[model samples]
Target: MYGPGDVRVEEVPDPTIDEPTDAVVRVTYASVCGSDLHPYRSMAPSQNGRRMGHEAVGVVEEVGADVTALTVGDTVIVPFSWSDNTCVYCREGFNTSCVHGGFFDGAPSATQAERLRVPQADGTAVVIPEGTDESLMPSLLTLADVYLTGYHAAYTGGVSPGKTVTVIGDGAVGLLTVLAARQVGAERIILMGRHTDRTDLGREFGADDVVPERGEEGIAKVMELTGGDGSHVVVDAVGHLPAYEQAYGVLRPGGTISRVGVPQYEEAPVGMASLFGKNATLTGGPAAQRRYLEAALPQVLAGQIQPGRVFDRRLGLDDIVEAYRLMDSREALKVLIRP
Candidate 1:
């Protein structure tokens, strides 16, 4: 979104499976991501008129002959990045950064399109079990991105039972990070947000406290809720300079900060001062999709996790403009767009 309201549902050629390692998925549910909104707001328009989606859940319409693990009718979650299972990083549990076709190389394109060609099918697509309820699409679809990313944020931050954790954003990923932190057993969840709807869902999903402020003031609230030492872990769900500053500001000395926000231009500077002085750990990236989605699947199937709760509104692909605007304006928490 170079200026605001730049996304449009345009016609593109029907997608086809390009290789034995690829599969064409008929996207059933795709949601607007906070990261997607960055380009629409301040970043420039993509040069390729590219398809704009990274998170989606769909049925395998067609699979390459070599894609033996997935068959037609199998439902799957497409992660933000794609990777070949045999790659070096994949062997190291860093599937998002596989030696071949990593996040940048074979991203495939955004899930906002009607049909998406999933590259590296065996490695990147997490198949949802057969007979999964259709109503779970909104939640299951989230396993592709925000929810999984949230899981990674909490996972990397060392969130666990009895630990006090603070999350740094109220966007869908931030909201899901709260859910992840709670599911992982953070005794106290402090979510940072100014949106009533987001904070409300955070509480429902297990955030013990919500801060309706910004910057240092918000950090103050998180510290207050934690009785002044700050949380044992802080998740910087908002990927920006300000959010990074806030994450550093309120973290207890030595507490870890997990940053998952896509930066302003795919690259941006982050906290270096506090990270070094306090001897705190700061890590950021797209979630380890393959590593976490499998663990998260059963939670959704068992109905223990309602990751779909972040959807404040749902729309058809026809209303892409308004969907972009609502998310860009921060008027909606998460928007689910069906194709």
Candidate 2:
């Protein structure tokens, strides 16, 4: 994004191998993330002509000499962040926090365009099985960030069989969280959202109930659904003051709140009354896509899970500006961009 609400597509130099461990990918599919809208909505600062996307699935066009796992013509899923996967944090399943890891935005090459230069290729690129169905690309693409993010929310929230899960927000990630909750065996999944179309998808994704209300009303509905005890786990997929409060309010004492939303505010109003008093555990951040891809890829491939259905619109790279506008205006669930 050049600035808030301003995204331009310009021909730029193609990506080439710069590091021995790097690989250049010919991206086949990429998508705009909910967090990408943060900068589009003026919630964050962006540099002029900054490369603008982090999710993509593609074929390796070239691999540096040191690259071992991936090779030319290999179909791969590029995780949102690049990591060496050998650092203490990566080994501990915190790939997003790897010592040498970084996001795609502001990088020399981004997935938004036709090509991407993936650093730490051995650890950052996941090879799909040979002869995998091409139709599964969108679903596999989601593994780069959205699906993993939702899985992180569910995993951190302590979702398990017989546990009630309440997911806040109705965006793509939120809907995916509903799927993640089901995968975790949550007995019930309650999604708080207002959009009819999105809530419908939430149900398809396994939400037991959809609360159109917000704030206290939404909290009361969730409590009622949980027999006045609130949910055993709550996920705030929309990071903001109200969403955070709602997530905290509709949680059972000692239950956890897993937040995957990018925080748009400077300070969260967390305190004793809202947290310590209830022993509400809070845990969530940038998802470690590499850590979760192993478990998720199979589901996508087997057709047991289809998160790609969330893409209600598809556009080419040249139409990315309208892609952003559609998302910003809430006219689309998610846009799949082909390059």
Candidate 3:
């Protein structure tokens, strides 16, 4: 990304193993994340463009001497963030907070390109079994970030049997959160989104109700659906202040609000009425995707869930600008990039 609204596909040098723990991956699939839109909309211009994209699935082409878990020809899902998995935080299932961890976009090589130089390969990449069907690539790609992110929201929110979940936003993460909630056995799931196309998918993913309204009206609708008590958990997949407001508004007194969206605002009401009075918990951040990748991979491989359905459009690498435009304008829910 050069600056706001200017995304380009420029030729760059191929990557190579740069550290003892690093490996080079030939990207087979990559996608434009919603969070990428933040910098896409407001990032300052740069002399040298920022390396964009973090989600990817690829074949390991070369590995450093220390990379024991991966070898040449191995297919792997590169988590959006890289970490040395043996850190204390990683042992506790918080790979995103690993002492030596960093995000892919922060590295010199990013996943959007045809090749990526992955640091901490053994701990950051999940190796897929050999001979996996090519048709399942899209689903496997979700394990890199999207599906695990949704699961993170549900997991952090303490979503489980007998609880009611209200997912705010119908984007890929929100819809998948509905799926995640259902998988964890939530009794009811309510999706708040105005787009019928997306909400429809939410239902298929297990949302029992769709609240098309927003603000006070949306809150009221959700409250009514939950028998006037509000939901046990509210997953805010939209980072706007309004979405946070709706979360607290429709949350039951002791419920949790899990946010997976990249927040747009820094200040929010955590005051008496918004949170403290209800004793609600606010949690969620960059997903520890590596922690959940192993568990979710089987589900995708078995054809149990089609989280990849969130991708509504596909484009080649050269058309990346158009892909960004499609997603920014909401013309595409998500775009799959073939590089």
Candidate 4:
């Protein structure tokens, strides 16, 4: 990844149940995510060839004896985070940030593999109803990650009817943010993006107006769209310093800014003075994946939102290295691999 082409796919051992609450799944579809690229290519360590991918949908092949909610052969969506519903944080609706059993981070054998050993299956995995069409698998897969994250972004923004919301970034998560905003009855969705195709798709999904600029230029455009008052809610799906600063610039007084993009590092300029001047509220973190999955299931089942449309390319697991290259260069919005 440091030199521009570093992804690799190799045979790995099948995951086995390691706990009474664990489950092993046979992945049917695995998608490469933007978060996976940074560490592989941009981070200082440049960790080479860790098990890639965070989002996937598949069928459970086996479950721990104590796992009661999920059964073998049931189709399910595996969110990027794992949790135990009985934890205090889970009881408070922050299951994503649960202290006991949430977020299986730093493990190389993630959802990208053909088989995944998912801990806390009863709380972390959601079942897809029987009789669901195979063609709809992609959208269902999204409910496991980006779609749910986007929904969390909108939810954290306090979105409701008549609110004007501005979404930064046009990646898959960004576009889904538009869809989630629309679902919550946002009146005006201003999608900020640079690509024609992605912005076009944003319109189809729900963006009322698209701003194709960045930094000060994009800030000016958003101001114009909001009648000089700025949007009521601003969502930051892009996390670098510039994008973070721009997200702050385009919000109205007392508006809420929700951040979903994984911050590249622990520190970044927040422009706290600007936010304080506007009397704005700031929120966002690792998504509450379980909280939103149940909500997205009905929409996906009814075909109200085709979240899977974000995946623009597909390849076999054997072509994994090139798949990462395409994604790293932004040549593909979402890439799926059949392992």
Off by over 4 Å in 4: 1-5, 44-49, 269-272
For candidate 2, the lDDT comes to 0.92
Q: What would the TM-scores of all predictions be?
A: 0.93, 0.98, 0.98, 0.95
Q: What is the lDDT for 309 in model 3?
A: 90
User: In model 1, how many backbone clashes occur?
Assistant: 6
Order of candidate numbers by lDDT, starting with the best: 3, 2, 4, 1
Runs of candidate 3 with Cα error greater than 4 angstroms are none
Residue 269 in model 4: lDDT = 48
Q: What would the per-residue lDDT of candidate 2 be over residues 1-339, giving only the tens digit for each residue?
A: 878888989988899899999999999999999999987877355555578899989999999999999979999999889999999999998998999899996687888999999999998999999899889999999999998899999987889998999999999999999999999899999999999999999999999999999999999999888889998899999988899999889989999999999878878756888988888899989997878898899999999999998999999999999999999999999999999
Q: List the residue pairs that clash in candidate 2.
A: none
lDDT of 3 by residue, 1-339 (tens): 989998889988899888989999999999998888889999999878899999998999999989899989999999899999999999999999999889987478998899999999999999889999988888888888888899999999999999999999998889889999998899999999999999999999999999999999999999888889999999999889999999999999989999999899999999998999999999999898877888889998899998999999989888999999999999999999989
Winner by lDDT between candidate 3 and candidate 1? 3
Q: What is the lDDT of residue 175 in candidate 4?
A: 95
lDDT of 1: 0.81
RMSD of each: 2.3, 1.2, 0.9, 1.8
Q: Per-residue lDDT of 200-304 in model 4, one digit per residue for the tens?
A: 999999999999988899999999988899989999887777777887899899999999988765775446577877788889988888777787798889988
